[model samples]
Structure formats: C-alpha cells, structure tokens
Target: MDARYARNIPALTEEEWGVLRQKRVLVVGCGGLGGHLIDQLTRIGIGAIRAVDGDVFEPSNLNRQLLSKVSLLGISKAKTAAEHIHLVNPDIEAQCVEAFMTKDNVQALLADCDAVLDGLDNPESRKLLAAACASSNIPYIYGAISGWVAQAAISMPGDHLMELLYPEETVLGDKSVLSFTPALCAALQTSLCVKLLVGRPVNTGTIYYFDLLNQEFEIIPFNNR
Candidate 1:
C-alpha cells in the first residue's frame, strides 16, 4: 500500500484496496454531491470514474458545490470534476461526459460501470437512472438533499427503490439546499459506495435519513411497491 493510503489501514484491508483499484464507478451529476463523491472516490483509489453532467458552474453554485470556484464560473461541471480528480489522484482514470443523463442515453453512459452514484437533483432524472441501472444489473447509490435534510439508499438491481422513495408526483426542481447538507450526504454516499466496492455487507433497500437541524439520523426499511 502507498503511504498516501496509510491512514486507511485496518479500516480498509489490503485486499479491499485492491478491489477498489479495479472498480469503476459512474457519478451522474457534478454539482454539490457529485463534487464531493468524486473527490472521495479518487482519494480512495477507485480505478476508474465517469462523471456526467451538462451544467456549468454558476455564481449560485459557490455556496455548496465544492468543485465550483469564482475562477471556474461558467466552466463545465463534469470537466471540472474530472480535472479535480486528476489533480487529487492522477493514477485514477477519470472520464468526463458533458451531457445530461436521459432515458435514451442512460444505458450507454452506465453500460460499463460497476456501480452508479446518483447526485442528481431532479427526481425524474434519478428515476430514469435507477431504472437504467436496474436493467443493467448494477447497484445505484442514491442521495438527495433539501435544506437541512438529506436521504441516501442503495438501489440494487430490480429494487426500484427510487420509485417507492420518490413518488411519481414529486416535483423535481430547485430547493433550499444547505452547504453542509450535500457534504454530509455525499460523504455517506461515498461510504456506502466503498462498502459495495470492498464486498462488504451493505443494507440495501433501506433509506437513511439525516436531519441536520435536529442532528438526528434514522434508517427506514423500503420494500418494493
């Protein structure tokens, strides 16, 4: 193991690190959650990462998006994320796809990935990605944030966990997201992703909720509807 990963010893065995070095993950959103997810994954030694996003950094993104900077204003989110990943860990292969994930392109984008991480803000887009991952038989790690609240879950193949968690009528639009919300949620998502990559037992089909306002965390079982 490299000295860079010295601190991760015991928590992550040598065998686990080897597994992470061969895993490929796709992060479908490069804003708040996406930035943090990519950052952690790169540091953890994920062999390959595909970052997908069509949006550009804006002034509003400065408050929460870790990859956003005044100098990077108007820069592509996916490109910025890939750049940051290379800066952090040049050994990891980072692929940037500057396109919005849609039903037509989801499968192709997620085709070769071992797992998909959902950092998308739109519930509809998340649903589409979840369906695509289910069809591809890949695990989808879902995370969302609004104000001081955030939720995360692992939607395994055929689980349809997002459909039950995010109903069809849910309006997917801008919400008051705090800076700490995505940071916390993204960290949790990365932890879950690492567990999956390391072949650790993860509690799939369970929604983990965090309420920062009250500093409370809860896990709710999710059964297919």
Candidate 2:
C-alpha cells in the first residue's frame, strides 16, 4: 500500500483501494464543490478525472473555492483542477476540459468515465448533466450546497432523480455559501462516489440532506421514476 493512502485502510479494503486506482470519473464545474471534489478524489487515489468548467476564478470565489487564490483570480478553474490534482497525486491523470457543460459537449465530457460528480451550482446544468449520465448508463453522484445546507444523491440510469429534484427549471441559483459548506458536501459526495465505483451497495434514488446550522441530518428515500 502506498504511504499516502495508508489511512484509507480499515475504511477501505485492499481490494477496494486498488479498485479506486483503476476507475475514472468526470467532475463538472470546478469552483467550490468541484474544487474540493477534485482534491479529495485525487488524494484518495482515483485513477483519472475529467474536470469541466469554462469559468475563471474571481474575488468572490476566494471565500470558498479551494483552488482560488489572489494570484490565480483570473485563471481557468478546470485547468487549475488538473494542476492541483497532479500536485496531489502525480499518478492520477487529471484531464482538463476548459468548457462549460452544455448539450453540445456534455456527451464527449462523459466518455469513458465510470461516474459523474455534480459540482455544478445551477439547476439547469445539473439537469443536463443528469440526462447525459442517464444516456451513458453511468452513475451520477449528485451534490449541492447552499448557505447552511447540502444535499447528496446517486442517480442511476433511467432514474428521474434530476426531474424530481429540479421540478422547476427556471429556478435561479443561490450564491450564498459559507466556506465550510462545500467542503462538507464535497466529502459526502466523494465518499458516495467511492462506494459506487468500488461495487459497494449504494442507495440509488435516496437523498442525504444536511442542515449544518441546525445540526440536523436526514435520509430521504424516494422512488426512481
């Protein structure tokens, strides 16, 4: 076992840890949740990551984005994700797609990915990503964070999780987020993804909701459409 992943023992069996080193995942968006997702995925020894995001970092992101810094204010988030992942684990292949997730490019971005991580902040993009994942027959590990709340769910193929979660497409995104919110949500998402890729039992269509300010957590089970 590698020294860096030595702590993964007990929580992960040797076989499971080895499985992680062969799977590739696609992460959409590279800001708050996306940044932490890439960081954790790399450290835990994911074999490869396809990071997609066309946006550049700004001052507003300094508060929560792990890859954002004063000197990197105008840098591309997707490219930065690749750099950070390489720095964390040089063996991990971090592929950078410097483009937003759109109907035109979503399919190509998801190719050869074992799973898709939802690091997107908006509802419309999330819906598009879910649809793409469903079409590709890939598992979608969804995570979202707001001011004091976070939600994580796994959407298997043909599941209506996206439609049920985002019934209203016109819903505007909420920008209010605490520095710790994405970190917590990203951890939850990363764990779920690990379980998924390593053939562990994951409750598809079940949502894990957390309210940090109220110190409450709930497991909400829902039927898949």
Candidate 3:
C-alpha cells in the first residue's frame, strides 16, 4: 500500500470503511482515464471493482495509460488494470473483463454495481453505458478529454438526462484524445465517485470543463439534470 493511503485510512471511520467496502464499482474502459480511476478508487478502499477493456496495450499507449509500459505491451488493458489494483490493495475484489461492451453485455456487467464510472474512450460506448444506467436508474459518473480540455457530467435515470443534455453526435465526436487530459479528468471522476458514495456533496448535475493550457476551469449549469 502507498504510504499516503495508509496515512489517509484513519480519516475513514470503521463504518465509513465498511460503507466503501460493501459498495461495488464498475469501471468501463481501462485505458488512460480508467487506469488512473482504478488506482485512486482502490487506494481509497473501494471494495469490489470490475475493469472492462478489450484493447491490448501498445507502445503508443505508454504515453498516457499508466498500465501501459514497455513491459506490459501486448497485455490486455483489463489484465494490467486488475494486476495494478491488486498491487495497491489485495483486500479489494477486482475482476478483469477483456471483452467489448455491447448493449447485450452492458446490463450484466452493470448488474451489482452501486455506481458506474464512464471512462470509455468513444462516445458510442459512453452513450450505451448511459442508456444502461438510465434503464437501471443507477448513477453514472462520466468523464472525457480531448487535447487540453476535459468534461465531466453525472446522469441519473428518469431525468431523460444524458440524451437531453448531450446529443449523440456532439457527445460522441470522432476526435482523438490526448493523454494528459484523461489523467486529470479521471482524477476528478474518481473524487466525485468517492464523494457520491460516502454521502459527501459531489456537486452533481453539472459538467465541469477544464483547459490545462489556459489553466481555466468552469462548470456548466444543468440544474434540471
């Protein structure tokens, strides 16, 4: 365990640790954002985690994906993420799924999760996850990054939320993502997940956008969501 995590454990009371331990989290896309999110979540004592990613780590991914390194090349993202989580805290339950997420498999993958983290790289998969969460009426924490910009939003079912807010085409823009952006976005997503689960104010119903180059951070108001 990291020294920082040991230092932070006292902040979590026995009841609080129990609450976090019992909660299950499903993390989709174990790439750049997913890697960081998994690390943070596990360090915070999240009990069970499901890591899903079909892609294999390549040399190109080493730049941003923490699980991708020279030695891990050719390994599946899910495998690397699962292994990393165990290294952080063997007490937590971790599962690695190296399959593409379709509408067919989405529900089962999401079945027992207390919450879903959308670390997916593409908008189509993101929308699919949102739809599943909507049908199940579970909270979905979403984060995406492109270039120096990142955006995050939380959608709860019955709001007709995600589709109403971010249209399919706009949300799923066919653009490449830069590495550093996902790292920052994933950190925020992890923090929001912990806060939401621990009865803390997560500032839900808002999309936060930050530009690393300009050092500007702004929140988009979506009170209706």
Candidate 4:
C-alpha cells in the first residue's frame, strides 16, 4: 500500500483497495456533481475514469460547480475535469469526451465502464443515460439535487428505478440548486460507488433522500412496476 493511502487503514482492506484501483467508472456530466465525483474518485485511486460533457463553464456555474471558476469560464467541462483528475492523481487514467450524450453515442461511451455516475440535471438526459446503463448491464449511481433536497440511488441491471423516479413528459423547469446540494449528493454518490467497487452489499432498490432544510433523512424502497 502506498503511504498516500495508508490512512485508509482497516476501513479499506488491501484487497478492497486493490479492487478499487482496478475498477473503471464513467461520470456522465461534468458540472456540479460530476466535478466532485471525479475529484473524489481520483483521490480514492480509481484506475480509470471517463468524464463526458459537451457544455462549457459559464458564470452561473460558479455558484455550484466545483470545477468551474472565473478563470475557466467558457472552458469545456469534460476537459477541465480530466485535467483536475490528473493533478489530483496522475497514476489514474482519465479520459475526457467533450460531446453531448445521445442515444447513438451513449452505448459506446458506457461500453467499457464497470459503473456509471449520474451528474445530469435534466430528467430527459437522466432517463436516456439510465436506459443506456441498463442495456449495458452496468451499475448506475443516480444522484440529483433541487434546492436543498438531494436524492441518491443505485440502479443495478434491469432496475426500473429511473423510470419510477423520472416519469416521462414530466419536465421540471430549471430549479435553484445551491452549492451545498451537489456537494452533499456527490458525497453520497461517491460512497455508494466505493461500496459497489469493494463488493459491499449496497441498498440497490432504496432511494436515500435528504431534506437539508428540514434536517431529515429518509430511505424509501421502490417497487418495480
């Protein structure tokens, strides 16, 4: 074990750390949640990461996107995330795909990954990404934030959690997402991903909801309808 990860200690056994270091994860958005997810995954020693996002950093992103800054305004989010990952852990192989994810490209993008992380803001993209993950039989770590509320879930192969959570034609207009919202959701999503990487038994069908305003946490199980 490298002295860098020595502090991980008994919490992450040598075998578990080795597993994590060999896993490949794909993060499908490079904004708020995507930035934090990539940062945490790199530091935790994920062997390979592919970050995909066609959007560029804007002034509005500074409020919640960790990888966005005044200096990086108008820069590609995927490229920025890849650069940050290298700075955090050069040993990890980081790839940046600067393209909007569509049905034609999603399968190819997710083909080699063991798992996918959802950092998308809109329901349409989320649904499409989830479908891709489902078809590929890759685990998907879903996280979303609206204002002070954040929710996370793990959708294994064949799970319809995404469909249940994001019903079709129910478009939610851009809602205010505070800085802390993505931070909190991303942390939870990272923990779930790590657990999956280490072969831990995660609550796959349950959605963890956090209402920061009310300081309440709830776990709700979703039935496959």
Please provide TM-scores, in order, for all candidate models, with all chains considered together: 0.97, 0.96, 0.90, 0.97
Segments in model 4 whose C-alpha atoms lie over 4 Å from true places: none
TM-score, cand. 1: 0.97
Instruction: Say what the RMSD of model 2 is.
Output: 1.4
lDDT of 4 by residue, 136-181 (tens): 8999999999899999999887887888887776777659999999
Candidate 2 residue pairs that clash: none
Model 2: residue 131 alpha-carbon error in angstroms: 0.6
- Return the clash pairs for model 1, or none: none
Residues 65-182, model 3: lDDT tens digits: 8778898889899988899999988978999999989988999999889899987876678778988998887899989887788888777775554666667557444365677888
Cα RMSD (angstroms) for every candidate in the order listed: 1.3, 1.4, 2.5, 1.1
User: Where in model 1 is the C-alpha error above 4 Å?
Assistant: 172-174
Clashes of each: 0, 0, 0, 0
CA lDDT, every model vs. true structure: 0.91, 0.92, 0.83, 0.91
Off by over 4 Å in 3: 1-5, 9-14, 171-176, 223-225
- Reference-based lDDT, residue 191, model 4: 95
